[model samples]
Target: MLIFVLQTLAEILAGGTSLTSTKQIDFGHPIDRREEATEPILNVYVYDLRESKQLQHSGRQFERNKTGSMQTANVSWPPTWIDVSLLLTAWDKTTLGEHHLLAEALTILLRHRSLREEFLVPELRGHGNLSMTVAIEPAIEISSLWSALTIPLRAALFLTVTVPFEAQTVPKSLVWDRIVSIRNKCLPGSDVMTITKRVAIAGIVKNAVTNLPLTDTTISVVGTEITALSSEEGLFFIEDLHFGNYVVRIDCPNYLPQTVNFLVESQTYVIKEVLLTPV
Candidate 1:
């Protein structure tokens, strides 16, 4: 997977900018890529690769698909952002010539926002445009990198690209679906009184015109404590509802609030077509 990502990066550099049809571009250590004499070439060294600390991630997500008698749950992790830092050094014999090559490379890369889809390999096509930033400020100190390579530092362009690393699904068996609770209380020398009975209500909220599921919608039973927030697929479940009439309220951003009255006569009630109109 790493190999595919790196190969695609090289393709992006050569295809998108002035470096098109240029075979002088190479990857790996800069010193090894330099010719013995003054033949100019650009070497791309991957100095750092780490998970981006900026992109926030939500909690884990799980989806279930039922097949005949078997039900399985698949855990889908969020796509991770891998920040790759590349050190672009121009290899030449003379200082003046090396500066010229570096300037050409930097000129071709400056003001670029993202890696285009045309240059993307098959694996990277649908992952969205790879965001990139190029500047003189290397992610790591140039002197330190040159010291490790046992060579002197030269002018280089630091390029950072954001790559999304997607994870595979892990399947597991589905557990029990429903659970109910009952509570009983007795007063001093008095008859036993039932406090509450477990009842459930579930439904999906959608756009009235588009008929598309609305995520992050809030569903609640008015005048009661039972409530639930809609999932990504617009499904909401309010558990432990009382066996009586309910005024359910649905609220979402940029959408008008809605209220519906329903009487629950059974343990489970599934409401349908709970649509909300947009403002």
Candidate 2:
């Protein structure tokens, strides 16, 4: 993945600048030796990698059918967004040449806020476009960075690229076999079939006085063993219940227990909010 990004950037700069050969572009540590004896080179050094917290999502796995087959494939949880920081430095014997190359590279990068899919390699093309931001780093910070690298301070552009990691894929079971086996099963009875209807009950528990969420509250259906504990957000859910009238009881420490009656219907979700009175 790192190679692909560097290559793409090299391609863009190589095409835009007077330097026709991509060999003039390099990706390595800033302290590395520059091949200035041959030609002026543009070095792209990746210094940091971190996950983007804002783009994080629920880690839920899903399955999709492969092309032209009844078999399904499991796709691992969504890819995580990662931020890659690069220091772009132009290496030339003359200071004027260095500034000119840096300006050209900056111009090309600024033209595209996000890289186009057509420019990406085959592996990254399916992931969609990646976002890139070019910014100027403070002189003090830049000097500190060069000091840490044990190299002389030079003019450089700070580039941050946001890209997604690919999700893992695995083969899942075939659907046709399960369907055929179910159809083959025969019950020695009339042809009339009865379908069972289910209902979903979901709600949140809160404090009666403060109206704040009450976590760790236990909720149960009367005359049944079905029960669920309220989450940190004071939310609880119970599903696959038969259509009927049910009494829901809520219990929590230092709080008065409460009971309420609700009706459940087929193919419907009943939402209830329980407010527990504090002792």
Candidate 3:
């Protein structure tokens, strides 16, 4: 029997979730000088890592209570802001089970309160549950039974959270560990998945004048959008590259963009280094 597990960590920003007043009611209470009602005001802002940009000019209203005790607001039409985002990293993809694990990890993030406020609540408001579809650049093909069993289960887990007015404050180090545990829980057995594809692709990035390993340089695959940075040791790993042709781009302010094409084949790997020169 083959067992698969999913794992992921979702970090929610502060103030990602909030409460808004939907209806104005007099309550037929005596309006006296002793008891004055403070009118509720609505505030909207972008939830990106950058400072909040007020959407006051957008003129969108808070959606009234759908039911229970919840009032919510919409970010904006067409969802122009990238405030809520996702950073997914797959440690293993050699087995079909790992793909299932990846799907499950993402499912956990979509429902996590911090993830919701950061990514989902901006667009959906009131008591309604968030509907999010996971999109990967280089899609993974998996079994019908796995998808049928995992997809809705993941969605149900996300719907179970009570949305908060602020992003969840979790320690950065704990985030990675917590998601791994959560992924294991979603599966039938095992705590972690061992990676089969671990290869080092080393190279030197230097100044045109002085040849050296360009420390702190970022290497990214165009199609997969997967990336890694060269260490002070001047070595980096593009771990777990799926089978395909990709354009590797190197970016540095002082140097011109370095673009190269490489192919990653199944069960086999390549070791190639790059040299970036100043323009």
Candidate 4:
């Protein structure tokens, strides 16, 4: 279960497009006393898109047939419901947000370079789990998920797996963080002039441990009324300033003071990349 959860998350985060929900029957209905019994086969596949409400992938089918009289047809009943939502809920969305985690993971697992496609077969087990035997490279990591027998199979079938990004990361707030100065150089055999220009300086405070991007770092140009705040991208841009030497500073409650000296020239824009060191 853990491997499957991680596999799905990894696939989604890697931008995979296809998703599959599969099931297998280990023991089909027994041969009826009065008639020949038939086995059942089922596989459901769904495709994801950039927009919500994606379509299901076509060409997959499920089939089941009854063979004997009602009395003779009595056989072991296969589990009909399987809920995959709980495992999906535990995924780390911050790393794979906006990516199709299931599909990519399947692709990685399906790729067995040494084995031919005919030899490498993947079949879902009776418990809604996938199993494959092929000559391939094993994944770098594999987690064994503990199985739970909470809900009955039929009731569990309705639960959907959703990894919401909002729940994984803290919401970012607006903040002003840094000050930058752009300067123009007009030099000749005569005199050199230094002018002060203001540029944008802003970046989010990210946790070194979790690497989650932070927002609301205070940014300002010293001795000036100009100020700006970092956006969700941890970027802050300042506009309209004379070119010259300027000190760009970033101040946040938990992080250390981060500053840079930059000179902007002419109509060109200057960009500074700041990584806030964790205190």
Task: State every prediction's TM-score relative to the real structure.
Answer: 0.53, 0.54, 0.28, 0.26
Worst 10 residues of 4 by lDDT: 151-160
Q: Where does the lowest 10-residue lDDT sum fall in candidate 1?
A: 179-188
Model 2 segments beyond 4 Å from truth?
32-36, 63-75, 138-141, 170-279
| Candidate closest to the true structure, highest TM-score | 2
Model 2 per-residue lDDT tens digits across residues 17-80: 8777899887867664454436788888888788976566667677666554234555577778
- The number of clashing residue pairs in model 3 is 7
What ordering of candidates by TM-score runs from best to worst? 2, 1, 3, 4
For residues 1-279, write the lDDT of model 3, one tens digit per residue.
Answer: 000000111212112212122221112211221123243211111111222243212343333222232122223232222122222322221434334434555555454533232344332343244323334421223344225334221211111122213232221110000111112222357455333324423233555555555678888878666888865545555654434466788776688878877664433344455666787
User: In candidate 2, where is summed lDDT lowest over 10 consecutive residues?
Assistant: 176-185
lDDT of 4 by residue, 81-101 (tens): 222322111112232421333
Query: Which regions in candidate 1 have their CA more than 4 angstroms from the true location?
Result: 16-23, 36-39, 66-71, 173-279
Residue pairs in candidate 2 whose N, alpha carbon or C atoms collide under 3 angstroms: none
lDDT of 1 by residue, 1-279 (tens): 466556775665565544544466777577754556345667787878998887646678989787653355778887888888888887766778778777766766663466766666787777667777888887777678778877676677888888778877655433223443212111145443222312256667888988777889988789877678886667666654435577899999999999987765443455455989999
Q: Which pairs clash inside model 3?
A: 5-101, 6-101, 15-166, 15-167, 17-165, 111-158, 205-214
What do the candidate models score in CA lDDT, each in turn?
Answer: 0.69, 0.73, 0.37, 0.35
How many residue pairs clash per model? 0, 0, 7, 29
Candidate 4 residue 87 C-alpha distance from true site, Å: 91
Report residue 146 deviation for candidate 2 (angstroms): 1.7
Q: What ranges in model 3 sit over 4 Å off?
A: 1-197, 200-204, 266-268
